[model samples]
Target: MTGYRCEEFFGEGRRDAASVMAYETFVLENTDILDYLIKSDLIGETMKELLFVYKTLMKEGMLIHTGFDTDYEEMLYRYRNNEKDRVEFFEEVLDDIRKATGVNVRFCLWLCDSPQECLDSHNADQAKHLKEFEFDMYDTSDIVLADLGKKGKLCGYEKLPEASCSVQMENNL
Candidate 1:
């Protein structure tokens, strides 16, 4: 199994919401020096890494937000009653992501082996850790089972907290 490549939203404050936001604000404040640093060779290694991680997490968070909700049970309920088909759902997600992040990300809806597996991963128990921190949770209509990236090389997936094992078993039964 590919075991789904999952991106942990935060890491010991490295990618936490507050850190990301603060660093972003700092970057915006320092825009005058940003182009100079980039054009010149004065950019330090630490700054380079921070910028890379920030951009990566921001994009990943946006992708996850498009396909998930804060509350697991409510997310599942919406999934059960969703009226749009897969194409419609994914397309809507793609559009929203573009609008939110201003990045043109392409998604592959059938990259995963099964939709249920994707749901299980997205709502896995590990995601519950999110409740321990502070971040805005998206109200999603379905579990997004797609890989996010470029046109031919899509490669990102994520799982949030609070997945219900009983719900999985109940559905299986």
Candidate 2:
């Protein structure tokens, strides 16, 4: 009734279906990002710039493939084929997503040697971005560091309580 069973019920083994579900969920959950961009009148410009950066990173093989969605695959393919107009591609996708869904979900991206490093990277990134957006920083670093230090490594779904859907690391790896 939970854990792997829940994952199985979601058809996790079927790449296409899982991907569609993930994308749909992402679109629905992050409507605020779209709304913010629209309100700031930076949606088109941001998308173009982001797409360029994404394509360049992909070309340099910096973007890791996590086997989650088709959009990533398409981006990879375009990068490999050298047919991607980075600016145009990113703008189109961002614009379409924004127009379709108005939410903007927070995303944490990090590159670190260890879990703590990852957390630090995430915090730093969040701080910088939030500041740029003129948003208040909650300073959750100490809490996160304490929790991760106590846990040792990131907690998997199985280790969490039955009623809890949130993801947490169990160890500080």
Per-prediction CA RMSD (Å): 18.3, 18.2
Output the number of the TM-score-best candidate: 2
- Backbone collision count in every prediction? 5, 22
Q: What is the lDDT of candidate 2?
A: 0.31
Q: Any runs in candidate 1 off by more than 4 Å, and if so which?
A: 1-84, 108-173
Q: Per-model C-alpha lDDT, please?
A: 0.31, 0.31
lDDT, candidate 1, 1-173, per-residue tens: 32222233222213222222233223332222223222333234554444344344333442244454434323323433443332243344344444544544342212223334443434446556443322222222122322222211122123222212221122221
Per-prediction TM-score to the true structure, in the order listed: 0.19, 0.20
> Per-residue lDDT for 1-173 in model 2, tens only?
21111121122222221122223223222232223333444345656455444445444555445552456555644544442343334335534444544522122111122433444433334333232211111112110100123212111111112322322333322
Question: C-alpha displacement of 87 in model 2, angstroms?
Answer: 2.7
